[model samples]
Structures are given as structure tokens and as C-alpha cells.
Target: MRILARRISVRRTLLKTGSEQVLGIPKSGRSRAITISPQTASLLRKHQLRQKELRLSLGDAYRDRGFVFAKESGDPIQINNFGQRSFANLIESAGVKKIRFHDLRHTCATLLLAKGVNPKIVQERLGHSDISMTLNRYSHVTPTMQDQAARLLGDALQF
Candidate 1:
């Protein structure tokens, strides 16, 4: 069940009871598919294969839940515990500062915006209600980007 694609749907969040339920984004109440890098897609494929192997090893004890990330017995990992237990260790091993799991979302948005990605695309990927929200949140203007914008503006006005 490996999917090779740039987009993954956000239809549901798995619960500890092995349930599939849709969860809307707070404030906006919108859910949308997120575009991912090919490298990320490949990583997800490998993770899925590993999960399948774990499930088969568990036999009758395994739950056939549809979570992209699940426990060995197919139970959903608790979000907070996942950060404190799993992510914290990974960050420490990588020698990165300790940051909350939720900060990843902000980092993703900031990186995308910094790379000159369109605000609308970022908004859709982040499930933001509007482009204005995306702009307000991730409008981190670097000196290089500002200089580039100025050059483009000068070129346009020269004509």
C-alpha cells in the first residue's frame, strides 16, 4: 500500500481506540490535502512497509487500523506522549534544541514562505482559511528576498 504522490489527504486522525475520525483545523474548520516532498513520500512508503511487517508479526493481536503512523499493535500513539517520548529523543540525538511538536507546523510554513512559495499555496497546504492568514503568520522577509524583490520591481519599472 505504498503511494507515490506529492499530496496526502487529511481525512482523519487516528485515535487510541483504533478509530478513524475526521478532525477539523481549529478556528478555520477546514481540512485539505498537504503537498509533500518526494523524499518525504519515499520515507512514508518505507514507514508503511515497516508497519505492515510489524502488523503481520503481531498476527491476531494486531489491529488493522488505517493510521499512517501507528503503534506496533496498530493503536494510535498519543500526540503529547509522542513528542515527549519519541520526538524529544530524536531531537536530542540530532543535537537540536528542544521544541514543541506543534512548532514544526510553524517551521514548515516559515520555510515555505522564505523560499518564495506563493502564499495561496502555503495557505491551502496549511489549511488556513485565507491567504491573508498565511501572509500574516509566515511573512518572514529575509534581506536577500527583499533585495530580490527590489531588483524585480526596478526592472519592471524600467520598462
Candidate 2:
């Protein structure tokens, strides 16, 4: 789970079935590679170093399982427990409405689209099967983006 430049290997299987954490491929049934910002790479590197320190301090007491987000013993954290505790606390502390953890993916897509990143690029990052899916899912964000683009174009022409 090294978050190196251009990529971070989370190393967890990407599927959920009922309550069981069955390890397998993603919903698209294929692997995906996405790039990250240098800032993000730096943050992850820091996190990895901290994790290593914890591992070393714990010695044989550390489980050393490869899951990136894990319990004190290095076992995978249960999603339900994470939601009930960490996610809930985070929402309250941030003064934001409670949202499913999965909603972060939708939020990321919408924010990128609104910022004028190409839909195809967003599709690839989201591991969507096709561009249409990304476009359709985030269509609500497009009108505002279109308006922004028009404003920028008009401003340029006025110069």
C-alpha cells in the first residue's frame, strides 16, 4: 500500500457483497490505474512512514496485514464499524450532513466536472465502463460549468 508518485496501491479487493468482505476485482470486473497529485503522493508517503513506525514499535504484536486502513492489530477495519464511529464523528465535527462513504466517489466526480475537467478523464478516474455513464451521472453539474466556461470566454474576448 505504498502511495508513490502517480499512483497509490490500496491493495484491497474492491467489491462488497451483503455484509461479507469478499475480496475480488472491482465492479467493472477490471483493474484501473489512476494518477494522483504530487501533494497527495507526499501525504501518503508520510502516512506510510507513520505506519511503519507504528509497526516497528509494536514488534511482533503488529499483525502486518497489507490492508491500508486497518485495526490496531493491522487487520482490515470493518466497514460498518467505520461508518458508525469514524465517519459519523467526522460528519458531526465538520458540520456536514451525514453521507454514505460511497457518496465521496460521486462528490469527487461532480467536483471535477464542475471544475472543467474533461468527462472522459473523469470516466477513466472513476473506472466507469463508458463516458456516457460519467456524463449522465453528473449532468446536473454541467450547466454551471457551461456558464462558467461562457463567462471565461466572454472575458477573454473583451480583452
Candidate 3:
């Protein structure tokens, strides 16, 4: 299935349901492709190349899994393992507050919404069932955005 996110089109959905956990899919069961920024795309390409090199170096020992992100042995990494190990370590080293990896998704949605990206677009990118879900979940607006909204409303009401 082709996944299209606004103007950007990605080849396939990198993630799928697993035995331990199920990734949420839209109500329609259709995969939605997300278009990422050019910089992000470049980073992904570099990561894919590194993964390929690791796979070749490991030769037969590599698991040869399809998951985009995998352990050095090419084995799929469990969310709990990543969260408690890599993610937690990174947060601790960076001196950031402890937060679940899932919070990153919320942060992304909040930042995008506060930046004025259309709610519908954010919803599509997030693979939410509908725009209302996106609106309800990430309705937080920054103080700067709130001021901008007020100014825009005042201008509109000006005679």
C-alpha cells in the first residue's frame, strides 16, 4: 500500500504490529505515508547505509530483519529495552527530565501545532483516526502563539 503524507511520499511503512505490542493504525487499516523534511530524509538515508554496512560486516550472523531500527546484531529491539536502556541513558546524560519515549510523539505534535501547522495535516502525519483526535490531544498553544492569535483577532475586528 502506498502511504502519502501531504506533499511528501514515502515508499513503505517501516513499522508494523508485533507480538508484544501493536502499533496504532488508522481506523481504515490503510497505511499513511509521512513526508519528512529533506534534512530528515538525508539522516534516514545515512542511517540505512550504516545499517547495510553493519549487516554486510556481520554476514550470516546478521538477522536480516526488515525493521528500520534494529540492534547491532540486526535483532529487533523491544520497546521496554530501548526505553529503559538507550532512551533512559540518553535522557540522563542530556540532563533532561525523565519521560517515556512515547512523550516524544506528544512533544512533536505539540510543537507542530503551536507552530501553526494545520490540524488536519498534523492528524494525518500522526496517523490519528481523525482531525478531532489531533485537536483534542495536542491543543496546547504557546504563549507567543496565543499573543499572535489575539493580535490577529484584533486586526480582524478593526473597522
Candidate 4:
């Protein structure tokens, strides 16, 4: 889903849910909007619904932790936490084969290239600071897109 606003607030009675801040800065920053597929959007909506349920279950004892996945004990989510470990374990159990967390990023680029998305658009969605950076990173996966450039030129010339 695209981050429509810089910050979004989620309000709940008797507790302060606070705002979810987008990661970006003004005047040519790296962070930008990324379009999520419809399936992913649905999953995210479901996840949000589950989080609401969790909050309700905890009642007044629920702490207003400003994290998407924070422990009831009020610990901030960290990279080395059980949440990340559990996710890694699930990926391993799925037999995805030797892939690092970083590789998921490359996989997204490859998929976008395979689906014939414009390189520039993909670059924007990925939030590469520059177009050249995106080109350098995914050049190997985007060779076929070169053919489209010739087609575009031909189409333009015919008009």
C-alpha cells in the first residue's frame, strides 16, 4: 500500500495508539512510496484487524506501545528479537533455500523486472536515491527491458 500521508494516526479509546510515521525527508530523500500488490494489501488489512483484536483483549492493562509488534511488557521491537527469529524460522521451514533477509529486496527487483515494470518506476518504488543506483543494482535482471527501448523509439518515429 502506498503511504498516502507522512504520518497516520490510529486512535483507540482509553489508550493512545499514536501515529505511524513514514521514513523519508523533504528535498530528494531516499524513502518514498512503494505500491503493494492487492494480495499484500489484503494481508496487511487482516494483520491490522488482528492487532486491534489483540489490543481489545488486553483491555485497560494494554500499554500504548508505539510499535507495530511490541510486547505487552513494553519492550520496543528490535532486530534481534524473537519476532524476527520466528519469521526467519518460518522462512527456513518453508524450504526457501539459502536466502538472507537482504535477498528479499533483490527478489522484489527481479520480480518487478520480470513483470515488465518500467525501470524508473521500480527505482522510485524501491526508493533508490538515484536512477543510476537502481540501474546498477538490477541491470543483470533487466536485460530484456532494453528491447522495449528500441520498440519505443520505433513507435515514436512512426508517429
lDDT at position 60, candidate 4: 71
Q: List residue ranges in candidate 1 displaced over 4 A.
A: 1-4, 14-30, 138-159
Residue-wise lDDT of candidate 1 within 24-123, one digit each (tens)? 3344554457767889898888888898898889899999767788777787677868889999998989999889887787777878887878778888
Specify the poorest-scoring 10-residue window by lDDT in model 2.
8-17
Local lDDT at 56 for model 2: 92
Q: Of the pair 2 and 3, which is ahead by lDDT?
A: 2
Q: Provide TM-scores for the models.
A: 0.77, 0.80, 0.79, 0.62
lDDT of 3 by residue, 1-159 (tens): 221232344333334456544444446477657778767766667787998999999999999757578888977778778989999999999998999898887788889988878888888887787787777775666788889899999999999
Candidate 4 local lDDT, 1-159, one digit each (tens): 222233223222122134332323433432345556667666666766776687788887767555555566434444344436866897889988766666676777777766777888877766676888776775454556567767888999994
> Which candidate number has the best lDDT?
2
Candidate 3 TM-score over all chains jointly: 0.79
**Tens digits of lDDT, candidate 2, 1-159:** 455556865344635578666677766777667889988877777777888888999999999867666777777778877888899899989999899777788888889878778888999888889888888874455577778889999999995
Q: Candidate 1, after superposition: displacement of residue 69 in Å?
A: 0.5
The per-residue C-alpha lDDT of model 2 at residue 141 equals 57
Worst lDDT run of 10 residues, candidate 4, spans 7-16
Which stretches in model 4 have alpha-carbon errors above 4 Å? 1-31, 69-76, 82-84, 142-159
Order of all candidates by TM-score, from best down to worst? 2, 3, 1, 4
Q: Each prediction's Cα RMSD? A: 4.1, 3.1, 3.9, 7.9
